[model samples]
Target: MTLETEFERVSMPLENPFTISRGTQTDAENVIVRVTDEGGMTGVGGAAPSPHYGETAETVEAVLPDLLTAVEEIGDPHALHAIEAELSTVVTDNPAARCAVSIAVHDLAAKRLGVPLHRLWGLDPSAAPATSFTVGLDETERVREKAADAVEAGYSILKLKLGTDRDRELVEAVREAAPDARLRVDANEAWTAREAVRKSEWLAELDVEFVEQPVPAEDPEGLRFAYERSALPIAADESCVTLSDIPAIADRCDIANLKLMKTGGLLEARRMIAAARAHGLEVMCGCMIESNASIAAAAQLAPLLDYADLDGSLLLADDPYDGIPMLDGEIQLGAQAQAGTGARPKSVE
Candidate 1:
């Protein structure tokens, strides 16, 4: 079947200025992708490029022509394996761009089959864990307010971004604000090994569930040092990028954090999850700041994940697209009545 393709960029402001250890973000840029089958069945997807991973909206737009060109050549959305394999060769990097195409193709394929994307993979929707709402770094008081707000909004789990000298103060404030919330912290490669180890102790004291990417990914030995000594379970985000990195990180972290934008496609993401399981690592699926276009695709994998941080779409001040339903932070994947990834454009004013 012949296919058609197109993409466009969108800029959306965050509800709050989102700050992490490395920096703050007032807005996010997403590149949206679409693939249409011969019968005019259209699939939608998006790319939320991360500068930390060496991608931006500009780069994603720059590479889509070639990636979508490969899809046109292949002429079939059902040939998921062949298309994904070809995408890798078409552009060795720009995973976020490739990811957009992958998502759209998968959406179209599942829609064509008259099933949701998760159903296509045979995943049990009820197995999905509640997603964690992120409290980006801020002054201790503002951070506390954010935590309180998240809890008020019915987020049962909270992932607080930490990396300042006031890390303890921040955690304490959040812990005070969200006493019963399942807590996780991500340092974004900001801490030293010793600092991570030390912080992990206190974080555990606050009843935190885990710490993520504490030490710089550039330091494997440091990660090992922290992982061996930390009181809380450690999740490897920056340290784990692909299926190849899974085995290497197996011994260094408790959780293997996977991002679709980082992995490039749904097939590779499944492979990473399997590889992580094989290596005895707990699996988490996180997302970059995004719209429902890509977050919906990520949510389809929630059933396979031990942890879910697919709240990227939730962080936006407003989203042009809506995806899977969420009730008190639990992803309602089965509630997605539409076929494919279950993303649809929100009504415009």
Candidate 2:
């Protein structure tokens, strides 16, 4: 058997400027990857690198050729373990690039079996959590308006970016607009332990479900302090990057937030989930600002997550590829009739 591999860089504008504690993004740059088997069947995936994680489109592009070379060398879609293991040897740090190939290989393997990705893994589609639409950091009024728009668009869960002097005011604005929506907040490591504990009390009063990454990953003790004192549960994103990090954070945070770009691939993501659960931490899956090519792959693991923040594709102004159907904020993995990850060119769909 022979495999053919190719990739392209794509840039798409966001619906609006997306800001977090770290910075803002006006556009999402992704590297799309495709791998084909000898019989002409193809798998699709993408890499949406985050600069915060020390990756960019250029880095993803630079690393993919080597990763894809490894995929083709294996020439077996079912050899995911071998392909990924080899990919790690090729480039250990470029996880997003490895993730793209990981996704493609998984998609291809599922397609060969003629089953949806979640189905292939025996996950119940109904078990998939409804994804939260994020309200990026912005002017108070604008943030309120975005929340209203999300409710109007049928997202029942809303994750708000909170990491500023006016964090309370910003969250209040969103609550005023989305009184009934399930709310979660991400500070993106902007606050000290004392400040996080203080804010968590008021945020709880406003019915926030949790506080995510209030303290930076570098300060593990701060995270533990906040977790011990905060009124609301804390989720660790920046703090929990890999399976190894899970043990360290298990005592510090209530939730373990995993992302494909950070984990490098699907198989490792599941392992992380299990590890988090064994450590008695609730698990959540999040994503970078991305297109459906990658977000769709993340959705496949929705059933395994306690909270789903897979709204990356929803932030895009437009996407060239269509993945799973997400109607009314619920990730409808079974909604797709076609096999694989439900990612294909919009033209093909």
Candidate 3:
């Protein structure tokens, strides 16, 4: 039976401009993939490309036609291992594309088994932790307003983007607005090791939960130095990409935030979570600015994580899919993910 595959490029406007140390995005360009088996069971997934990770929507689109053709030729959505290996050989370094294909296959497999992905993985959605909503880098007043708004909107955990010259001011502003909100920070590899140490100490004073990727990924020595000197726990984002990169930086950070786009798929992501924990690092499941398709895919792995920052869809002004519903930052799986990753087209009746 020949598998049928469909791909499309989508642009979703962000509710607000999201700024990080590396850059800013006012919109998200995603590639949505759907795989329909001979049984007419369709599983959907998406690729949210990150320029920081060397993938753009254009890059993802460029490689997907041939890649999807190869996947269709394989004709076995359930054999994800072979599919992933074949995909890597055809499309190199396009994790977003790989992630899209991988997730579509996983979704199909789960739907075929007539079980939710979490249950298929032998996990419980009820055990999943609440996800954190993010406050992007902005002026102090805007940061305060966003923080307060997020907190008031029922978000108990807030992750703030830092690493600017006014990092302290921004954190202070947010603290003033959402003092009781559990605050975490991501520097996006902008500061020097010494500077990271200083900022981490300052952030500790305000009760920050942890600092993510304070120093550059290229500088492992700097990461270790900052990790050793900082009073707060450190998490590695860019520094940790695929499974092989984990061991090299295992001891340098307290946590590893795994993004499906970075890992290339749910299989690799699950492996990454296990690998991070094996190295004694707490695991965080994260997402880029994506639709509910990929967020729903990542949410299926929520029961295995220590923290979750899967609110990328929440930041969007409009979403084209609905996989997992986030109610006030809480992951409301309910029965939505009962088939595949539980993400379905918003137009479905």
> Which candidate gets the maximum lDDT versus the true structure?
1
Cα-based RMSD of candidate 2: 1.0
The residue-by-residue lDDT of candidate 1 on 1-349, one tens digit each, is 7899999999999999999989999999999999998788999999999999999999999999999999999999999999999999999999999999999999999999999999999999999999999999988899999999999999999999999999999999998998899999999999999999988888888899999999999999999999899999999999999889999998899999999999999999999999999999999999999999999999999999999999999999999999999878999987999999999889887
Candidate lDDT (C-alpha), each: 0.95, 0.93, 0.90
Q: lDDT tens digits, residues 91-201, model 2?
A: 989889899999999999999999999999999998988999999999999999999999999999999998899999999999999999999999999999999999999
Model 2 CA lDDT for position 169: 98
Candidate 2 versus the native: TM-score?
A: 0.99
Off by over 4 Å in 1: none
Residue-pair clashes per candidate = 0, 0, 1
Give the runs in model 2 whose Cα sits over 4 Å from its true position. none
Of the two candidates 2 and 3, the one with more favorable TM-score, higher being better, is: 2
- Worst 10 contiguous positions by lDDT, candidate 2: 340-349
Query: TM-score of every model?
Result: 0.99, 0.99, 0.97
| Global lDDT of model 3 | 0.90
Evaluate residue 48 in candidate 3 and report its C-alpha lDDT on the 0 to 100 scale: 97
TM-score of 1: 0.99
Backbone clashes in model 1 = 0
